[model samples]
Target: MQVSNRIAIAWPLATTAMHERVDALRQGGEDVIDLSIAISHFPAPLPVRQAVAAALREPRLPYTAVGGAPELRAALAAKLRGENGIAATPAHVIATNGAKQAVYEALYVMTDPGERVIVLRPHWPAYAATARLLGLETVLVDQPDVIDAAFLATLPAARVLVVNNPHNPTGKVLTAGELAAVRDWLRATGTACLVDESYEKLVFDAVHLSLAACPDWEALGIVTVFSASQSHAMMGWRAGFAVAPQAWVSAMSTLQGPITAAVPALTQVAAAAAFGIGAVSELLADYRVRRDMVVALFAPVAWAAVAAPAAGPYLWCDIRALTFDTQGFAELLLQRYRVALMPGEALGCPGFIRIGFIADDEATLRRGVGAIITLGDSMARAAGGHACSA
Candidate 1:
């Protein structure tokens, strides 16, 4: 049997090694503190869990409408309009297994094989990998200071561009002005965009501007994706939705009908409940406290400098001063320190690492970060004070 060339060349999902090591340590009876993945440590809001339980008892748990459960779509549309300033109706919504699928389906509908897909680095690896799997070419560009003429000149004739705000790994929320510039660039280049706003409520000191909220967003060809995974601590539920132009959404629905059939019936009901319960503010409060805890813990560490993440649940540490190479540092920390972190090499930056702060209790976070501090000191000493930055 032969595998496709796409499968042969694609890089494995970067977190796979982290998960495997964590499991190995647990099996060996070693205490492991994981900060690699961004899953919330908190439980699902009581109301949403109760809703899912109740929904399970109902007998109507069959395949739903291909786009989504109608009520959930309506609820999502209302939330997008009321909170995120994205003017959407149920007619323009398509629910998916998760925000990842929402993004993939949007790409599937809006782009074609052999078309160029532009992604800014450092980025979630899935963005580029998914494009490759779909027979699309990925053009990776260093995230620039501005979408100016020079930056525009470097882009290929791209079909879809991926943007993640309250961005992963770095956690910097894209400001309104930045979004405006992106909108202008998209229009000028005749490109469509898939903006992942999964961390919509997770912004800390900055505001999250949705591309779909841009004036004349439809004309600019933007698709905005939101997920209950982060907002409601429903990662296992795999419930999310996307808002795009009606025609594009219809096309996605048609594709989804044959692909996934529908997102789980009961999960959709729970998602609708999640939107109505209004518990996100409380969850955000917890994450905010945790974020602050991380800042205080790492503030005085000389081997590495920590920037308070402007949004999301991560702390992006510039570890170049500790070690010029991050993957080596991350592996050493995992094996010797029993702490897991995301190396920036996984996200296309080589001198940093991302720590997800919301996935562990304060005591565990303190301990994990303490280990990282120790490892940094050791690595810095090993490097003999020779280090560099990105």
Candidate 2:
């Protein structure tokens, strides 16, 4: 048997691979603390649960249009209008299994093979992975602290640009001004934009502004994707949708027909309920406390520097002072201390690590952080360096 060239060239997403390793260790009776990716400890919002329950009581769940049930898409369009400021109609909405699928399909329909796609570094692995799967040339640039006209001018021309608001790992939310810069850049470059706002509702300090919120959004050719996974703690539900120009939605729907017809009927129900319910205040409070605790714990550690992120569940730690080989450090930490984390190399950055502080309880979270500090201190001492303050 022979595998296709595309399959042979690609590797499993590093974040998922680490999570599977943790799952395997636990299954083998080895205790492991997983911080590779954020998985909320909370359950799906009650409204979402009730909506699915209501759907279950129906006589028979029939398939809807490939895009979504007309009503569901209408509701999602209203969400885009009221919540996101995007002027959308049912014709512009397409329900997807999750944000990942929406991203894959958007890139597929928007760009051809060998076309350039610009992705900011320290991004979600799926952005680069999906581009590779479709055989697009990915041009990676370092994510600037602030996105402005000057920074935008430095990027190479590309067919599409992928933007993650309230970004992964670091949780840096793009401000309204930053979003304006992006919109202006997109207009000037005539480059299509794919904005992933999956973490919009996870915000803590700053507000999330959608790049497609402007009046010229359709003219700009922007596709904004949303997911229930992070916002409503509905990871396993795999409910998400994309808001695009009507033609783009039709193209994505055509591609989706042969792949996965429509999102499961129940998932569309959950999504309608999930996005309607605003921020999960209780869950946000819990995550805020955890985020602060992790930042405070790392404050005294000389070898690591972590800031309180504006949004999202992961903490990005800079460990370049200790070593640049974060991959090796992460591997040895998992082997020696039984703690799992994402090495920055996987996210297009080195000498850093991303810790997800949302999954485990406080005690377990503390223990995991302690183990990491202990290992780093040991490594520093062995290298004849000063001990970590922690």
Candidate 3:
């Protein structure tokens, strides 16, 4: 039996990998702590839950329009205007299964087969997998700081550039100036930039600067992807959409129509309510609290420094001082210490690992950090030396 190449492509589901590795370790009766998945174990705010419960009562069980319910899109329009200062309307947005699907649809709709796309490395691995599905050649750019001229200069032939702010693995938030520089390059070269703001609302420090905020960026050929998963903890609800020029909206619409007609109408209603939370700042406060706990634990670990994730709920750590490559080291931790984390290599950061602060329980967070530190100490001891010199 033969399957299409697109379906045959290898996709690294990070959370699944963590679960499998941790499962094997536990089956062997080894106690393990999982710090891999970027999902919040905390409950979706009560108001949001109540909203979803109320939505279930509506006659939204049937399919809605391809772009999504008009009301939800309108609410998102208000959000874009209020939060990011970008003007949008429901007509220009097409809701999909989730941000991942919106991103996949962006790639599918924006490029034809064999077209060139640029994914800045230390990026979500799924970005690469999604490009490969469409048979697109992806040129990767690796950087440790804000996107620069050299980075933008590398993708000379790219038709689209996928950028994730408060980046998945790295948790680096580009300022307006940094994004502007890239936008200038895109305008000069006529390259399309698909900015993924999946974790936009999970910010811990500063407000997320939307690439779509600057008027020039929107005109320089840009598309934006957002999901309710992180912000509203609506992962299971599959609430995501794309905001783009009305002219190109048809491409996404045509692509998403046959796949996911729209994000659930009920999800739309629930999300609308969630997005209006006046107390939503608590989410950021909680993420920061957990992030700080992890940072404090790793501070004395030696040979490692937290990247100080300004916006997202994680710390993109530089750990090359301990491991040759993160994957092997991470696997060792899973097998030996039973602690699972996402190896940085998957994000194109070989010497690093991405630690997500999804657990809201302070005691659980501290315990998880302790397990991680113990694992690191063991790994260091096995190396015949300390990772951090005292």
Best prediction by lDDT: 2
Candidate 3 — what's its lDDT? 0.76
lDDT per residue for candidate 3 within 1-390, as digits (tens), equals 997776787666665667677778779888767777667766677888888788788774777788877777788788888887777777767777778888888888788989999888878777888888789998887764757777667666779988888688667778877877877888788888898988887776666888888766557768898877777666677777788877667778887777666766777776677666633677777777777767777887886778567776667878777775888978877666666788887776788887767754677667766766676677778888765522
lDDT for model 1 comes to: 0.82
Error of 2 at 86 (Å): 0.6
Which regions in candidate 3 have their CA more than 4 angstroms from the true location? 20-31, 216-218, 387-390
What is the C-alpha lDDT profile of model 1 across 241-341, one tens digit per residue?
A: 89999999999998888878888887788788877765478888888888887778777777677877777777878877666689998888888978999
Clashes of 1: 0
Tens digit per residue, CA lDDT, model 2, 1-390: 999998999999998999999999999999999988888889999999988999999999999999999999999899888988999999999999999999999999999999999999898999999999999999999999999999999999999999999898789999889999999999999999999999999999998888998999999999999998988899899999999998899999999999999999999999889989878999999999999999999888888989999999899999998999999999999999999999999999999999999897899999999988998989889989886555
The alpha-carbon RMSD values of the candidates against the true structure, listed in the order shown, are 2.8, 0.9, 2.5
lDDT minimum window of 10 residues, candidate 3: 274-283
The true-versus-predicted C-alpha distance at residue 259 of model 2, in Å, is: 0.9
Q: How does each model score on lDDT? A: 0.82, 0.93, 0.76
